[model samples]
Target: MSDQTTNQQQSAAAMNEPLLSVRDLRVAFGTKKEPNEVIHGINFDVFPGETVAIVGESGSGKSTTMHAVINLLPGTGRVTDGSVQWNGRELVGIGRRDMETIRGREIGLVPQDPMSNLNPVWSVGFQVEEAIRANGLAKTKKEAKARAIEVLEQAGLQDAERRMRQYPHQFSGGMKQRALIGIGLSASPQLLIADEPTSALDVTVQRVVLDHLAKLTSELGTAVVFITHDLGLAAERAEKLIVMYKGNIVESGPSKEILQRPQHPYTKRLVAAAPSLASRRIGAEATMPAAPTSTFDVAALAEAEGHGSKPGEPVIEVENLRKVYKLRKGNFGSEDFVAVDGATFTIRKGETLALVGESGSGKSTIAKMVLQLEEPSGGSVRIAGKETAGMSSSELFELRSKLQPVFQDPYGSLDPLRNIGNTIMEPLNIHNVGDRESRKQRVLELLDQVSLPRELATRYPNELSGGQRQRVAVARGLALKPEILVLDEAVSALDVLVQAQILDLLAELQRDLGLTYLFITHDLAVVRLIADRVCVMQQGKIVEQATTEEVFENPQQEYTKNLLAAIPGASIELGIVEAGDHVPHTPVAGSGSAPFAGGGQAGAQA
Candidate 1:
């Protein structure tokens, strides 16, 4: 069908009737006697071929509401009141067998956290094929297998045939996520509920997945309920935006209108905290030469902070870093996979150097090497001008005190069995930093530094929300008072408001204490906000390295340009920058150079 025809069909479908109607939906968990209501009387509609996004922070009952609609709510969660209608059929108290028949056929779900959602025991192909067969999309086993491969490819997984045989544990985070997306899309359901579907993916891959979804929506008239914390993505993709806070729908309207002029205070805060909007606001406030377009001059903000002018002593220096993994083939031969290839970068005190790239681009590998978690095949890593290649176990343990790592998944990184206070004080106890009373005091202080409540010390990881858990992770990282922090995709999974708050906390800590950061992320919008200098990586090599402004404004490499262009909401015109609102220009101490070895200037400093 032509684009115009498809659009006209979509418009007509929207005018006809809503595919899914949720009216005054209420959801509660726990016992029937004393239920804890999470989703409180929320109303929304999903029309055929239209995309609606539910944007909110974690635990805002967005997921709960969706789960309630499909009868997939976890544990004791039940629809306490209200109604859910699918094609005029009431689904409030539908039988389990009937709901199962309608689930994958009429309403598909792509859940968040691919790791838990995917079956670890089964091959990726088997899972996809199972979904296809269960949905009655294919009859014969052969047909189901063929359909599964096609679905996987459509979901952006390259080498779908080979990947189908592989287990979930063998795939990277992004690959696993793609597999889940394939399963969700296998049946070509009427309505797809995508819950943070691209959180694990890089910008380019995210674009491809979303594009595929758009194409599916247009071609097949699939209505999408995209649940996400990314306001920018919500604005770019969804036609309607539903802002949820706590349990209520705070605002609902056109996506662009909500982003441009948010009515609710929570929505306003979300819009203001969005990285893309914040980057533009910072650029407007800074005094710098404008780019060819209206791109934010992040380099100018770094310059305003005295980046590249006054060089601080290099705290961490990596030269010719290389990591190779041997892939066993048939238990007889092995193939070498070069993860990091001669990557070199220098991070000075009080500076933030961002390593930006797609998944499998060696960013995390480099971070692991720097943290001494993985032994490098070849390279020199120096800390405080001292070589660390031949460090003893004792020496490495001592070095860990000065160098700490904050990983992407806060829940995975933290110990669920331990309370927040003990988790924070673990390093202190291991290193014997202070006595019991002193260590307890230090934990309280660290909690305050991370802007978390002191009373939360007794709470466990599962008890806290995603943002609070991340703050606890930060506090634990700071327990040793590390000089350098290696944050790998730290804020990629967080909501805009929480991400902004975490960035602010890191900046404040950097200013208060002269700490350095190695920020590894696939998010270029966030790179613009937090990075002084950015090193763009591709195929295990640094393709471009420069100050944040230079890279964003005048990207030399095509890959870098593609990464920047792939950013969601970059095309959206947010004309809400206040004239007097400016990012405070404070002089942060630091400067360093990472000589780009390919396609760009050597010794690029910020």
Candidate 2:
């Protein structure tokens, strides 16, 4: 039998009584002048109480499929073919009002970026309560507030009652995501669709969120359609996996089977590209390729280019850094929050030290303290062997040349009003490094250094892709010719291919520049790639510290072990297990949500 035919048969077998069934779904955009069809013929199913992950790279139609299923496709796009059915009801023919009824109450959706998904003007509570009020779940304001608080607590958000009164801007990125998740799941929807739910989150934070989701789904028996580009995430969290490439399901099977013995080339590439998998450091053949890198290596490149020798002293050192924030009183009581509790670390010349932890682990707080963006309650920050804690504003301004930062979101970091050329020139202008012509030349040189085209100089932030925006950010960081760069989740938003490219660029940059890097990120895969040393942080404390190889291969702390163990496919050993009562597989049946191959089992063995 042909592989395509067998794949179809297997797909059919997997979907017995699915909560949602998508058949031959197709979407297209543009006009007769320049038409583009995004999604071709595609099919999938979400079973009751089962979490099915749609794994694919960017622009692979995973988001488009979700938008189509929820009847929320943008005005520019249209569903050209196929049917989306929910609980045996045809969604394609449903009216706008009818579709709205099912959108939040029957099928909930959490978007890719929380900043875009939330309303900045409204209080978070009011926005969340609106869902309940709109759905007629709560008639009174009191009931709505009660429901909102309950939902927020369910989402693991602390100070739920007070947080509801605050605008989205008041919340941090991770907190905002948690609040948004509460809003999406508040209506008790039977099916939830999450798009890249924890993309840029720290591993420990990601675990908490994923654990919450797993608990909620299990308790409510709600079906989930989780969309992500991270293969490791899919392997750990998903019960069923559907691998998509160019809008086609090239592979679908049990999560373990798919990870252990991927039948598709795309899936194979995904596994190979994963940072967690490359962390397997032992028994590599002599001919094996070295692991992929993380972010741009500006420091290394500068050194090789003979751009001056390493400084005779440490670049930055923190001695008991502390940042305490006071939480304003709301509907609830007031209290002080200690974001960074006497945190200390050191970055040497021409080295990369990664800060690893989950969300709310105080990594960002520590970074801010070092950058002097936030005033530390107590402790000292010394840069280049000079004390920074008591430096005057003028002195701090002078220190800008020695310390620079690359923020997590390039879009937010760069001014939308300014073009790429002007953005990169800002640092040079701020420091009064050179005249107009010199700054322009420096901008072009930095752009070339980061592998960006000089022609992009005129393009605004909106005109550039995510990867291009990031490259621009890199160029800006290098504009000051700093000795140390603080990279805060710099490459977290990019795709595997783009990330690999950026990592290579960062490595090259580091080699030539001889600059130190304080790399902060939650992704262990990325940690494995670029970091020479690793520091595991929990609750604003360094739980474990070791060389990169030692930390990845022989982690000592339980937090570190649990974080490592939580990585998907970490436990798989390239073998298949026989189906048993404990390892259940759905038996195929005719006319179910999944295409049923006659007399066949629903799952594939590795």
Candidate 3:
């Protein structure tokens, strides 16, 4: 037989073996006094060489179920009922001694956040070596270190030898995730559980990481259980799809079948909300309720388009921007790291200009320069018409009032101690926008405008869901009534439904407020939905800039073309569920209503 045939035969043999089998899995968590049940009696199977994805919005029991498989339930959470068997060995009641032997040796986990999972104080190499040594993969510490480098290199981490000595803080988000994968595969585990592994990564970086993970797992015959909120990614990567809603398995089948003909309303809504699956804008009339009323007056927005006489000048303008960070190579020697070489873009009033690129592509650097956060080593940035190169402190402060940023990590951006109301009001208080009573009213109004319930105003940031927190972030951005809002991967971390809601909200706000948005993201698919123009960045320079449709349809640069091609699920053609089959367009979290009648898809807030 040919090599292909032989490989196929091996694959067939692997698939015949049941690697991990989960049956009637029931999980519960909360205080001992009030034991709350989540992950209601779910069942699934994983073959030795197959991939299965458990997908749903946050708190839909997807992650909770997967976490139960590995017996790693968080904070008082326990596998109350059902069986998690690996090769017929029970995982639920397994002894610590036995689970320890199996954890890194037979079952490995690539956690949700690489940054947090990795120890900040320790060197990356030390952590990798520890995993190898703990798994008995290497003989000596030196051998473990060498083996750790090999694993990282195998995981496609560049300069593995040198980077191994560096701390997790020194590595980029994508690189850190690669290192985590390296640690997960250090012992060549039979089963790998990845919990939304690349949710925080750039699109290109996500593809690269997932590709490397696939190649390594396939070569080692590792069965993968992927937990994610991204439906498009699940459709493209997993051979089998498991749709979960409110702790129940709503649907399970082949990925393509589930995508094309979803039986569950929750699944259909997820399929509808994913930007990569549909060509239309989020909450478009074709998908949503068509009412004979004023929803969002885009016609009036078009009429009041520009800020100037007839046409407005760009809200932000950059010319030949450059930022060089000098890195200390040795005791005396230093190396110049050029973050942004030459990036130029213009965002007109009421227009959204997206800066797209892989990590370290200078997108955020350009945003910082435009926000006046970073002093450019060379080049010029103009806000409205005034040059910001040598502006005074007061002038820069005034410029800040016109431009505000919404960060990728909303929780990190927000203060933990402050309540949501005070958090939003703090900005107004700092700016002294209005008196105390009026500012309180403004806070409540902003909450309503963002579609968040007013009752949540008294709650702290931790009490809110990820989507709600991001909405609060948007509310704070609007507190100053800024003309230009720099959204740095603002919606990337959210699930499809939440992401769609946020995007739609931004679009609506842009129309009503005539806001100028600088959307910085790596997801070209998202850019297609929200941005008017696209600027593709490479290294530290702008390689391509054109209308959003032009860049997606006809690209000039090979880099831009490759970036567009690398978008996850770009090839998966999802058949839109018929209008009759569609369900109510509910927000992702904090909504208890079922997507379908009696679907029992009501999930807790994330």
Candidate 4:
């Protein structure tokens, strides 16, 4: 057929050329007086129809390399050496006019933060339309609008016509991401570069975007350059993987080969640290030679040996709790803001109770009240079977060792000037546990408990990864072996795999030490993996509370249902839900359009 012939011709044209090719690429920044070379000579080829992922931790030069390729590098930064070719044309030394022509049409970029991607003054439609216009894909303004709507719909934004009129602030995080994707795809570029595309997104949304990107690339044969720090994601998504470290490609190979058995030590450690039940199942040590017969459970023995966890009486109890802060505005200050209303919860001894909700759901407020960080207008917090309502500061301090909190932002929560050892020893020092030598020894032992190397005790917080610092924070919380641990989005900032590892560590600690957790987060995937019981909160109140299994399977409340619905790929049954809730539907796929060659951007390293 003629149509078949035309398609074949197009495929042939695309296959005949490399969309982006980089050779001996190097980048440097800073003045001539003091220049810093961040990207050492690196070479790779990116052909048509493949997803090449460059992965590494912070300061790995992955971002810098990508910036050079896109010609988005900051001042004082330049490609000191390299040859970049796109579509059989040289791009490294192209003029600005040619680069402008290629930017939107030839190279589509999806930055990390979707909220910041769009203009505050403009509607979502306008942004996409502008991209379309820049790409010269449409002849007229009307044509541009139509194309924009089509792309938005393709990005999975429902009611594209009406939604287009709304400003960026009106959309949720996931929706904002869809809008960004729409803008990126509107140009129909041959190459798509996504930088931490799904970071900060819910697992469900992350899944949906990944699936969509995969389908789009596969169908249209679009070459994709994906950048992320999450190794598990790289394993699941990329066909070719490039491992970078401090500005060098330490390892490069097929995803399966590299991830299954990485050749590099860094890669191996990265893979080993991901939180996984499978890993735990495979690695669970043989029941530590049963301790000599004892009156307490195994948890008690472990704790006595400095790792015990024996479930005792309920450590913290709350019933029908409520806290409301009035928002005062007008001259007389008459505005009322009901932040939390009738929020009720309880944490049993040696159990992890996850309180989950989106932003402004009053989860943090609850944690603050329990930690006595904030005074509750109306609520009863019982610690060690006694209500804390009328307790004085001295009384609260008396029971401080029994309750502890590990916050989300580790650096913010910790004193930056103090080394890890001092940070861990502070609580012990405050409680007057022991002399300096004993406290220092305890810090080292605690670090060991958290799987941190003993030598890291002298290192400052700035030297640790987000995960390592969080582990330090956890060690601090356990310094006094508190009966309850309140973690407020503690691991949310970490990469998925790091988050997974931390969660596994927590679960292991809980299992081995019987530590009770009031885990608070908005991440459902984490809630699924850790919580024994889950409380879904909305508008500062608990709308539902059930076993993790029950809540995940049969979420009863409308708000909880909406949160689930907002999740990407919810219709697909991933074994996270009961069989009855499964809904089957055909997937919508998109075409891949290659970027323009004359953009003056570096070719992607294969």
Candidate 5:
């Protein structure tokens, strides 16, 4: 037989068998005597060279199921029943030594949260080379170094050779994620499990990373098990979709079929909540009545009354905002780096003006200047017609009471040592807004406003889920009842359902309390949903500024156009009609409702 014929036969035979299979899998955590089952009887299969996606919100047991399959469950988690077979070999109850051998060499894993997964003390190249050497992919030290560089380059890291010596802290978030991908694929494993790999990345960088991953996996003929909470991304990348809800597979089918015609109520809610599907600002009337997905009333949320902004009344006026940093060059000389260059904008009394851009685009810097966290180089920030420049220390202190910030990483932003109640009350205590009893009452009320249970007040930050922690963060931001809330990538880290709930909460709060928002994010889909008007920033300059509809319907700037095109699942045919198409609403200057004119078809070819 010819070599080509032999290869073809081998490929054909391999297609008949599954690369990884799970049957009636059950996983539990805690003591054996008092076990808490998290993953109840789930089944799935991954064929060779196929891409499968498992999607669910946090605590839905999606990650647990994969961890059980690899026998690497955290803490006391273990597979109690059923089977996890790899190439027909049972993985349940496998010895640690045997499982370790199979882990990186046979089945690779790209974990979420690059900062926690990567060793901060070690160089990025060293980590990659270590994985290669451990898997015995390269024999010599020099060869391992070469292989590491090659893997990093393939994973889309620029200047791979020079970056090898840099530590994790030196690399950007996208770069850190790329390093993790390189390490995960260093051995060229047959099956790769990517757990929310691009969750934290911006749209453009996310597209680039996923494209490189797809290319590399295709070249190696490696099957991928992609896990995420993004339904649009799942539908776009995976051939098959498995929707898990509270430890059970609620729906499973072809990706497009599942997206177009979700049978389960949970799946239907997921599709409806995904911002990537279509662009429509929040608080707009629904064309069709939406089914109840959560405790919040979807219809009421959509039709929630807006807090009308006063004409010609600007609450925040940033005039020619400029922030320059001095970077130390060598030892003696310093270079001036302009972080925010002559940026200017205004936020009305009740409006959401989103500052959208990629990382290092100076949106956050502008936010800092607005909040008076950082002093501007050459500009003025006026709050309610009062200039903040040269303000007295006492006046700045009062300024902080009216302008509060809700940051990105809730856990990092929150004090781990404090209980939820105390955390929320800290702002009030520092500002001396109320007495002790009043502060306690204020904390409880804030929790209720954010839709968190009152019992959680006694719990610590670590005890709460990601979404819960964010709710707590919002409650803290609202404790002082600040006039303007500066949410900097606040909902970017949350899953779809939780993100929807947060948006709903923000809209409701805006209606009731008439709060103003300065939303900063790289997510154009989210910008479309929550922002009334958007300021597109690029390289420390505002590339475009217009209403959400105008920006999406007809982008004038190339950068703005590219941002719209980078949204994941922008090209997927959901087959269902969007409510935004039927309902046409006038764009209120600061009321936060506008029509979004785009489909989830961006970067489909990529």
Candidate 6:
């Protein structure tokens, strides 16, 4: 009875007051003489036990606004105006010492980029332990280490104990992100600020993370402010939604209202362009029509033409492709880790063959082998009918012009020092394809082809948004007019609208240039749309391979079916969560504590 009263008192106190209150918040960057303002006068109040989401495009100032709240703005940035109040106490201009105390204790932050936040030298476990100790959660190092494992386990890391010992360099992008999540929740603050925290995670992991948050919200009343470009996900997870555009809050209202009847033009465009909201896949008209076409319709007939002769021609073939890495297992008996195991698949000319799997599933390993970037331990990769295993240096150099790659991280793939125009022209220069003048002209033409503004030629890559940078990457990939393009998780990190645009652009290019694509991704929805065929991979092997229709309509394997069922917003179309829907869960070893949210109290309300 006493425990229940204490819980009631805590919940009542939290619900009675606004956890965070922001009004007319204005932030600025650049020199004093040349000032530039971002995040202009945004207002939002986050109460206890509620999840609020801020949705916008990359460089739309959504992230900047959040950074301003925590006073962690990058170079030359400062809060020029407005107020940020936590529990009626002014946070802006507060001394760093006091702010530090409040940061992890009252508000926990999960940064946007995991690679930037996690230290390369420290093990993930050490970082999580540090966060816990700093917050005064655990008394000793041993307790902190045990708590760290529990946190990682809750963040959906299957092998938390083993993974905790590994460093950041050893972990994949998704694994690193999950580790960050575990650290963020180590303190179990009153408020949790997640900025695209699960962007790197696959659909299933993403779902588990969100569901875990929902459970925390219900049990602990942990207010969450989720920042993301995924509008559909925001609508499904958040109660209140705020839309930002080019440094301004465009709209703020209930999530369902904003999604269904958006007041702003930008929000309307987002909803229309979001592929997850749409029932049918795009590009079906271009691929195959339901009925037959008339002979007199020249344009329609031209569109109706499939990869007629090119259907059987294999642009990329992998025969028993395998990649093995030697790993030292503690004392003795070193084990060979098989990254890719007999991953055989083919990409036909003018067709998109998608390799669908979660992180570390060897989809990327297979791509590397096909591109001749990585030497396979056991198999032969034939590119454009030529075996790549025994090709000479010059032969491989020549083969490069026939096959190009656009990697997932556009910023990393591109040189930041070079202007957008030069970045696109670098590939041409390397191949010695054309003269400087002609290359410049080709750059402009490619820019136009990708629908980017010609004015972006002078802009550096760091200045462009994620979508624009990816468009530039695509243009560079097309510079050589390669017969085949290997897109390695290219559009997975982008927003729905940007992803939709990229997909449409790729479709148009394939139609015009007859380009063959070896598309590697974990997104099954994208597979359903852009790919002609799908190959579902599990550990390091292909579990199922079939046409897009066959894979989606009737998935043969249980794993394939689970992948389809894991996508966000699919399970709940109504955009609402009911009571008792999410069962409370905690790590088995640390049963008393919640996995992600500091320590979940034992036998807490579900």
Question: Which candidate tops TM-score?
Answer: 6
- The CA lDDT at 414 in model 3 is 82
List ranges where model 1 is wrong by over 4 Å. Answer: 1-15, 120-122, 138-142, 277-311, 328-333, 445-456, 575-606
Q: All candidates' TM-scores?
A: 0.84, 0.78, 0.85, 0.60, 0.82, 0.85
lDDT of 4 by residue, 1-606 (tens): 699999999888878667888888999887877778989998877888889999875456776787787787766788889988878777777887887777767888887556556788988888889888877889999999999999877776767886787677656555677888778878767889887665544454466667777887888777788887656567677889998876888889887678776667666655554443222231145243222222212242232223223366666787767776653333756444455688776677667788876655678778888898877887688876789888988788866666789875565677766777778878877877656555665666666555566766666675565556777888898787666789987765565445654676676666655778899876665677778788887767888999887777788987777666555323322112222433221121222221212221122211
Question: Stretches of candidate 6 above 4 Å error?
Answer: 1-13, 277-281, 284-311, 331-333, 451-455, 571-606
lDDT of 2 by residue, 1-606 (tens): 999999988656644677888999988876656657888888888887899998865556788888988888765678888999898899986899999889888998988767667788888888989987987889899999999999888776777887676777666666777877888888888888988777756565577678878887888878888888677678788999998776778789898788788666667666555655455322223133343232333343342222233553567788888777766575677677777776777777888889988766788777877888888898889877788767888788777766889987676788876667777878766766656655666666666566566766766675554556777887798777677789887877665645665666666566655768899887787888788888888877888989989988898999998888766555554423333313211121222122112212112110
Best of the candidates, lDDT:
1
What CA root-mean-square deviation does each model show from the true structure?
11.0, 12.3, 6.6, 12.3, 9.5, 12.0
Model 5: runs farther than 4 Å from truth? 1-7, 118-175, 284-312, 323-338, 374-380, 385-393, 435-441, 575-606
Ranked by lDDT, the better of candidates 2 and 3 is 3
| Local distance difference test values of all predictions, in order | 0.79, 0.73, 0.76, 0.69, 0.77, 0.77
Q: Positional deviation of 347 in candidate 2, in angstroms?
A: 0.8
Task: Give candidate 3's error at residue 589 in angstroms.
Answer: 9.9
Instruction: State the lDDT of candidate 6 residue by residue for 164-236, as single tens digits.
Output: 7667766767788888888888877788999888777777788878898888888888999998877757878
lDDT-best of 4 and 6: 6
lDDT of 4 at 535: 89
Candidate 4 weakest ten by summed lDDT: 597-606
User: Which scores higher on TM-score, 1 or 2?
Assistant: 1
